[model samples]
Target: MMKVLLPVDGSEPSKNAILKGIEEGLLEGKEIHIITVVPGIVPVEGYILSPHVDDTNQQLAEETLTDAKALLADYPNVVAVTRKGDPGTEILHYASEIGADLIIMGHRGLGTFSKIFLGSVSSRVLNHSECSVYIVKS
Candidate 1:
């Protein structure tokens, strides 16, 4: 079975990527892995602000994965995962670990800068992924 890696961030583009993949018949008969990476919170002045921050981030990551999974309800071979780290790095690591045949993701995500041609995470993945990448634009 073909292994496809899909990284989402609960962004509209990311959701659209899933929808587009389904519409294009790209996810049929494939082992689809849906992942969401929560960026690690950095400490300031050698102290973390609040303990609940990590928990909140983790919850959000899981929610993101759940939402993505909902889009692929008909797909039997689907797995959802959550990771905490740099988004691009974690995505690449997961893809390599799974020996993915393809990576389908959005061209842009929920980032501060919307004017850029492509989101930083997507750009990094596009430039470095070992497998074929399909970028969906919203």
Candidate 2:
């Protein structure tokens, strides 16, 4: 069975990718791994530390993965996870670590401004991914 990695961020487009994957039977009998990556903010040495930074990020990541899991409820052999780091790099790393054959993700994540500010995650993943990458535009 093929291993498909679905990296999402609770966006409408990401939801569409999951629905499309299921409707297209791309997930049938395949191991589907749903992932959400939260980019963690690095603090400078002199900055005042917020004790809740990690907790907030962890919560957001969990919430994002939970929503993705709900969207993927109909798909069997599905596992969901969340990570904290650069989304593109994290997704690529996860794909390699899991030996995934395919990477499916939304073309846009969270907001357009973020994509504009930090180059598109999909574009970055496409450039660096070792395996086949499928970008679903919402």
TM-score of each: 0.95, 0.85
Identify the leading candidate in terms of TM-score. 1
What tens-digit string does per-residue lDDT give for candidate 1 at 1-138? 999999999999899999999999999999999989988988799785898999898888888888888889999999999888999999999999999999999999999788777999999999999999999987
Tell me the TM-score of model 2.
Answer: 0.85
Q: Where does candidate 2 stray beyond 4 Å?
A: 44-49, 114-119
Tell me, by lDDT, which candidate is best: 1
Worst 10 residues of 1 by lDDT: 39-48
Whole-model lDDT per candidate: 0.92, 0.82
Q: Please estimate how well model 1 matches the true structure, expressed as its whole-model Cα lDDT.
A: 0.92
Report how far off residue 85 is in candidate 1 (Å): 0.7
- Candidate 2: C-alpha lDDT: 0.82
Question: Which residue pairs show backbone clashes in model 1?
Answer: none
